[model samples]
Target chain A: MRRAGVVALNTFREAVRDRVLYNLVFFALLMMAAAVAVGQISIGIEQTVIVSLGLSAISLIGLLISVFIGVALVSKEMDKRTLHALLANPVRRWEFLLGKFAGLVLTLAVNTAAMALGLLLVMIYVKHSLERSDAVVLVAVYFILLKLALIVALALLFSCFTTPLLAILFTVGFYIVGLYVQELRNLPVEVMSPAMTAFTKGLSYLLPNFENFNVMAMAAHGRAVPGALILQNTVYTVVYCTIVLTAAAAVFSRRNLK
Target chain B: MPGLAIEIENLTKEYPFGFLHLKKKTSLEGLNMQVETGEVFGFIGPNGAGKSTTIKLLMRLIFPTAGSARILGKPISDVEMHRDIGYLPEQPYFYDYLTAAELLDYFARFHDLTAADRKERVERMLKKVGLETARKIQLRKYSKGMLQRVGLAQAILHDPKIVILDEPMSGLDPVGRREVRDIILELKREGKTVMFSTHILSDAEMLCDRVGVIVGGKLRGVGAPGTLVDMKTQGMEILFELRGTSNAPLLSKATRTGDCYRLQVAEEELYAAIDQLRAAGARILSVAQVKATLEEFFTNLVEADGTHTSAVEVSGK
Candidate 1:
């Protein structure tokens, strides 16, 4: 575990030094500024517009950062041959895999927090006072972070076995499919055969249900997220990330690395 | 066995290829060898002769399909045994974003070194590798030779008992190569076991206590560099300057270059040739015996293996 921390710290340092976080955070802030400008043109719904736009900006930028950087995490190491010297040390393969996952998630969390802070400052400037409803925006940002963490896990799992380009495609594919998993579950059973229904139902259960993490609508309407949903999202993200990361470690351990 | 630093028995590795990995290619086959403690062992081979493959398997960067190896009596699967082992891969590429100091410090943390110990060791290693001046610069900005130096620095930062290096002298200038050779010698003087792989035969001849010649996914020979080749004299060569050129007896057989003539004679004919040259009033410049070299021995092994394919052939395949 201590070795994992060392690898994680080095990985986080790599991302920070690469200046990837800076570009994405700057873009998110720019979008929030644009939201502020758009808020002024609207009448009596400035908070709603700002909350909706700010959270959307955070989610979009977070998704991009998560998917791109996460996929490169292991593949780039192997491509650059950095893993050759690293694994020669006493570090376990699973520890290295988990460390990379944790490092990217830490980067995402930092970027999301920076973007969320920018959103809060925008709210303060426009409203001239802090409102209790604005606290819900923080919860919505937290949920977006959970979604990004899940994406990082998926990207890492794909990265273990495929090229970065294919990993990116697979991660985005899973994310898009995962968003519509509830619809897949609710397909009309009257029109479909029993086998098709069972297949779709199994897929719905197997795929990550990302829809559950969407709290932006509730935040834009200034409605508080229920406590139960927050608990569910936290547990779901933990369990899902564990399974994906375990599979990643297993694949990476057996890889030839030639 | 108690004095052995490394031991291998029937170790083999096969890589799967083709669609769905149904077809397999053998990369290393039935390798068995051992290195005594405190001895410098050189693994010499040509390109694609399984030198790097064997080293990678020992480092656990890849797994073997058959057999097993042990380092310091611990099986290769024992992770704890790695603490006493240091490895540098061929053409080692480090995290380019990190400075030399930062990279060494990061690697040291894995050895559980404390802050002060890491700082001291990082500084010492940088100086040892002659990269102290460039320690603060990021690896991306470093030249290949400088990067090789950094690779060496990181490998020995923890001061392990055994060091395994694959092509450590690659990308180094002549002076850099000499410096690395000195480092390896110094490590041996300190009673550390060092195993390095190289295609450069002269380096092996100079520094290795013993060498293993590998070809065609198999080890062909293992012995001391001096004993691996034929010790019998191949012939004798004499360099002489005929004073006044009085039609020396062997002058017709000698090759002339400006002021000197050189002749090769069988070992039994050496003294007779010298007496004849003296009778002809010739001044002998030097006399030397020619012997078979490690390079010739290594080439013979490669040829005997019948797998010495050209680079173009390998690439096309």
Candidate 2:
């Protein structure tokens, strides 16, 4: 655990020093500024439009961080030959993978926090006052963090045994499928055949239910998030991340660094 | 076996490439060698001769397709064994964003060193490798030689008992190579066992107490430097200076070796060859033994086909 923490801190320092967060910050600012312009034309729904656009920007950029940085976490180490010296240490392969995951997750947390703060400020500027229900967006951002953590784990898993290009393709494929899993599961039983129903149900269980974390619309329109749903999303993210990380460690342990 | 730093039995690695990876490319083929405690063992081989592959196996950076190895009587696959081993890879790459001091601190943490110990060791090691002045500078700004020094520092920062270096002297100038040689000798003086791989025969000859000649993923010979060099010998040749013009028939077929004439003679013809040289008016300069060198032995091993490698097995202490 100590070794993993050390690795995690080192990785976090590398990301922080690399200034990767600047691009996300710039995009968030652009998103908020653009929301102001778009909200000006839709004067009646200024707070709603600004909050919607700002939250979307924050979530998309968070996903970008999880996918892009997470893929390179292992692949770049191999390409640069840093893994040679690192894996030679007393550190276990699982600890190394977990360290990388923890580090990137911490980074995502910081980035998301920055974006959320930006969203809050933009909302205040548009509405000229804070709404009693405006605090619900924190719940949405919290879920965004959980959702992005799962994406990062998936990216790390694919990158453990395959190329970054292929990992990205696979992760993006799962991402698109994850968003439509609800619709696919709710397909009209009257019109669908038995085989299609079984296939969709099996896939819904096998693939991550990313839609579980999608509270963007509710938070933007200032609706209450149920306590039970928050707990469920938390449990789901933890379970899936653990399974994927274990699989990554297994693949990484058997690989020959030739 | 207790004092052995490294032990291997039938170590092999076959890398799969091509479609579905069904076709196998063997990188190491049944290699067996050992490094006894307190001795510097040089693993000498040409390029693509499985030196790095063997080191990687010992470090457990990669899994072996077959066979097993032990470090300090523990299996190589055991993660706990890594605490005693230090490795410097061929042209090692480190985190360029980290300074020399920061990199050492990072690697030192794996050994469970305290923050205080880490600070002390990182500073001492950087100074030991002559990088104290540039300790604050990030590694990306370092020159190749400086980076090599950083690699050396990180390898030994934990003060491991067994130090394995793949090609420690690869990118350094002569001065840097000498410093590394000195550091290696220091490690030996402190009673730490060292195993390093290099294609530079002269460096191996100067440093290794016993050198292993590997070619085509097999051990061709293993023994003291002079012993392997003495294993192969052509017939002895008598050398004499060419004086005026040689008229004798015995001197007719002599080959000129610069200012001296070299003539191959049987061991029994010692007196008769001298008599011929005197009668032919050739001046006898000196008689010196022409023993083979490690380079010649290594060259022969490299040039030998797959069918000719020796089956000599050198085990642990």
Question: What's the DockQ of model 1?
Answer: 0.85
Worst 10 residues of 1 chain A by lDDT: A23-32
Superposed Cα deviation of residue B88, candidate 1 (Å): 1.4
Q: After superposition, which runs of candidate 2 have C-alpha atoms over 4 Å from their true positions?
A: A35-39, B234-239, B249-259, B262-269, B306-317
Q: Per-residue CA lDDT of candidate 2, range A1-258, in tens? A: 988998899989999888978867686668667766966688677766776777787788888888999999999998898988887789999999999999999998988888888878777777777877988889989999999999999999999999999999899888989998888888888888899889988888889898988888898789989999999999999999999999999999887664
User: What are the Cα lDDT values of the candidates?
Assistant: 0.89, 0.85
lDDT of 2 at A193: 89
For each prediction in turn, the share of the native Cα contacts (below 8 Å between chains A and B) that it retains comes to 0.86, 0.88
List the candidate 1 regions with Cα displacement exceeding 4 Å.
A28-32, B231-233, B243-254, B268-285, B310-317
Tell me how far the alpha carbon of residue B259 in candidate 1 is from the true structure, in angstroms, after superposition: 5.1
- Cα lDDT tens digits, model 1, A1-258, are 888888887878988999977766576567666666866688788788888888888999889989999999999999999999898889899999888888888888888898888888877777777788778999999999999999999999999999899999999999999999999999999999999999999999999999999988899889999999999999999999999999998898888787
